[model samples]
Target: MIVYILNVIIMALGLYCLIAKRHIIKKIIGMVLIEYSMNLFLILIGYRINGLAPILLPEMNRVQFSQYGVDPLPQALVLTSIVIGLGTLALMAAYAMKLYEKYRTFDMSEIRRLRG
Candidate 1:
C-alpha cells in the first residue's frame, strides 16, 4: 500500500517537473523520473509475498515451485526498460546539448524554433 503511494508521488513529481519547469534540462530530468517511477511500479507489481527466486532446484516439485517462486517477467521487463531508459537518457542529453548550443540558454520559453 505504501509502495503504491510512493510510486504515485514519484509520478506526480515527475509530471509537475515537466509542467512547471521552464528549463529543458529540468524537463529531461522529469522524463527520467517518470521512467524510473514506472519501472519501480512494474517491479512492485511483480512482487510476491515471501517470494523466492524463480530458480528450479532439482528436488523442488512443481507445487513447491509455484508457491515459492516470484514472477520473472516483470524483472526481465525492468531490465529491458533500464537499458532503454539509458539509451533515451543519452539521446535526451545529446539533444539538450544541441539546444544549449543553439539557444545559449536552458529556458524553454526562449527557444522560439520549437513552437509550431
Candidate 2:
C-alpha cells in the first residue's frame, strides 16, 4: 500500500521534472526516473510474501508451485523494458550532446531562442 503510494509519488516527481525543467539534462534525468519508477511498480505487482523462485523442483507438485512461485511474466517484462529504456536514454543523451555542441547550452528555452 505505502510502497505503491511512494512509487506513484516518484513517478509524479519525474513527470514534474520532465514538464517543468528547462534543462535538457534534467529532462533526461526525469525520463530515467519515470522509467525506474514504472519498473519498480511492475516488480511490486508480481511480488508475493514468502514467495519461492519460479522454478519447479521435482519434489514440488504443480499446485504447490503455482501457489508459492513468484510470477515470471512481470520479471520478463521488466527486463525487456530495461533494455528499451537504455536505448531510449542513449538516444536522448546523444541528441542532448548534439544540441549542446550546436548551441553551447543545455537549456531548452535558450536552444529554442537560438534556433533560426
Query: For all candidates, what are the clash counts?
Result: 0, 0
Per-model CA lDDT versus the true structure: 0.90, 0.93
Candidate 2, 1-116: lDDT as tens digits: 99999999999999999999998999999999999999999999999999989888898889978998998999999999999999999999899899989889998878876546
lDDT of 1 by residue, 2-102 (tens): 98998989999999999999988889989999999999998888889998888888888889789878889999989999999999999989988998998
Model 2 stretches astray by more than 4 angstroms = 57-62, 114-116
Q: 22, model 1: CA deviation in Å?
A: 0.8
- Candidate 1, RMSD to the unseen true structure: 2.1
State candidate 1's TM-score: 0.88
Candidate 1, residue 9: how far the Cα is off, in Å: 0.4
TM-score result, candidate 2: 0.90
Model 1 clash number: 0
